[model samples]
Target: MGWPYLGETLQLYSQDPNIFFSAKQKRYGEIFKTHILGYPCVMLTSPEATRFVLVSHAQLFKPSYPKSKEKMIGPHALFFHQGNYHSQLRKLVQSSLNLNSLHKLIPDMEAIAISALDSWAGREVINTFHEMKKLSFDVGILSVFGLLDESHRENLKENYCIVDKGYNSFPTNIPGTTYHRALLARKRLKQIMSEIIYEREEKKIMEKDLLGYFLNFKDEKGRVLSKDQISDNIIGVLFAAQDTTASVLTWILKYLHNDQKLLEAVTAEQKAIYEANEGGRRPLTWAQTRNMPLTYRVILESLRMASVISFTFREAVVDVEYNGYLIPKGWKVMPLFRNIHHNPEFFSDPLDFDPSRFEVAPKPNTFMPFGNGAHACPGNELAKLEILVLIHHLVTKFRWEVVGSQSGIEYGPFPVPQHGLPARFWKESNHHYRH
Candidate 1:
């Protein structure tokens, strides 16, 4: 579908990715062949095709994170795990971050959201992407990870930024290259996490956060997980959940800002819910949060449009066929998530941001914001809760607008608000605010 060795790698990196994929779709059918990022890959765009790869033949695939990413995130990453080990890890995470346990996170989440909103109230402009990243990172570390990176913000954030940029970068071993920097950053984070692990263990300190669960969780053999494994998994959890959720939250704001009607409607819903809970704008219980159906739809539509993780790669462990296209063994297969998510056939007038479209669930395999099959994101509830809680506070309190030289979306590896979606934000005074 592309060049001899490089395939469509350069085209993907340079050109508008939608245009690139659209042009290729016209040339080849939905399930076509191409080589990119050092593999002869098959890109699945159709829902049926994606399902066959992700579900029908789930066991035949493994996560295809590049060599550089493997090094940075470590062997404990769910991407590198498979079979029983992967399932066990997911169960452990779900146990701690699930609905019941999630209630404990609400207060911290609300406090952080309020403090951040207050900070922005006096500011001239806020970068949506940057600000959300800080908010998400803070909540994740302080509330979710047992304050693991509570005091290591600069060091941890620097290393995470390096690793994230290197996720899709060329795997060059040269001293100045992105890959090299990412590797060095990975080393630093490992050292930092290792220290945190040891400190927690030696002190025998137990907090109700995910770190405590990880440290105390034992397998069938009654053996607790090692410090390195816990540390690596913590890094992986923060890496996977933090930025992507932040990106979605940023886009949610941008969309709400663009459509005043939607913003008002969502705000009305939040206001009603808060008033029902005695009108104090306090952190909500789990049931209270999910009770706002339209707010939930807004979250869903935002996820569909933003599609933070545009594509997920899996390595075919054996030869497979989809839509009569032979997918050879060992080839990398990527589910073109956004393509399907944005497909006109699946969503009427797909390009439009209409939260009402989510009123009715799409057909099977058609709406996969968190992916599908065995590898679907386990922390989906937590991610949604984070977004839900933050948005609850936002629409209930503030009115914001995009303000910058230009505003748009920069979608590739992740969808982010272009130019960081700088915006002017302010909320009513505390007395005038709902209380």
Candidate 2:
């Protein structure tokens, strides 16, 4: 703790958070106590400790977030709760992302990726992360609502962007503030969702989407999910899908850009699939997407390197002890994902961008990009599917060059390449597409 109440919040925010975390770990060992965001938190960096908190002893800790954030994303979201409600809501979400559902959405996901890449082609300079966000958002929508109308999609995107921008801003309801605008936008999102939900209910549509699962849900007590509950969970899933996936995609681009040989290898791997698909005339099969071992390793390495979620907050529901330390009830417990990922003990030469390292899996519990245990990201499968689709089309049909210095990282609450990795893209000539 730095100050009486302010704590080390300034120190954490004023510099690179990784640097702060590293410094603290060096001085205080793998487990240390620090106050952040007005809460006393115990930060655990070792894999055993992390596993204990997130997996084995998870019942003693409940998901926690700032009240302002809870309100911003809708308090009814599953991430803010545990127990029966969380379990039930999580099942509904999982039903929509299951393999059968994702298989049906593959064509739509590929279409979104192709359209996005085509639009970015020949651009002077586009922010790769922002463009990727659009692609991910479209896929997210497809997963949640099936084929939404254009007008509805546009409205949802506009409002959602406002809410996303304001999510990390200072929590002030004062007039003319970013957070205020965000709150208003969040309301608009809820209203828009209500209209969509009402339409589904009135039409009696029963499609195999997340909305369908929510619509058809009835609990043990025969209680149906409230409209507010459904809306919050949809928004929450979208929030989870967008930035985290986009950030990792951006890092993949930067890492490939820095290493010509690796880029060539990844492109070659994807090119084999392109040729087998009859020179880009065929859609990728689920099996083909599953077979790109080299590209898959790249994805795994990027996730490990980015560690976007970084650390998650879980409050001690009751006093708990681990490794001879006591966590008082109500204190926050954080498992430092980035630190664990970068620790040399787990990943040799951790700072190097080596996709090959993933050829052999890391020891159990050492690699958790989407978190661990029950509250892990539900849309993870869908996220990977969309990424594979995009990369398949991208490497086979387009070539891009970073437009600015590509060495810096920026955190808009998640680590992304500086300025979202400004880059220029052009279509790969038809000659290259020929067998």
For candidate 1, what is the total of clashing residue pairs? 0
Per-candidate TM equals: 0.92, 0.98
Q: Kindly list the per-residue Cα lDDT of model 1 for residues 1-435, writing each as its tens digit.
A: 568788788988775667777777778878776889878888889988888888988888887777667777887776688898888887877788877777878887778788888888769987888888878877767644654544666678778888877877778889988888888888888888777778887989988778778888889989888767876787788877877888998889888888877887888888887787666545588788878888889999999887787789999898876666778899999899888888898998987999899888898888898999878888788788888888877777777778964465675367787877888888855524342
Residue-level lDDT of model 2, residues 1-435, one tens digit each, is 889888998898777778999999999999999999899999999999989998998899999999889988899999999888999999989988898888888888888999999999987899999998998889889999999999999999999999999999999989789999999999999999999999988999999899999989998889998999999999999998899999988988888889989888888999998899898888888889889998898889999988988899999999998989999999999999999999999999999999999989899999999899998888888888888888888888999999868777788889888899999999987737343
Query: Model 2 misses residue 92 by how many Å?
Result: 1.1
Give me the displacement of residue 259 in model 2, in angstroms.
1.0
Best by lDDT: 2
Candidate 2: 10-residue stretch with minimal lDDT: 426-435
**Model 2 ranges with Cα > 4 A deviation:** 433-435
Best by TM-score: 2
Whole-model lDDT values for every prediction: 0.80, 0.90
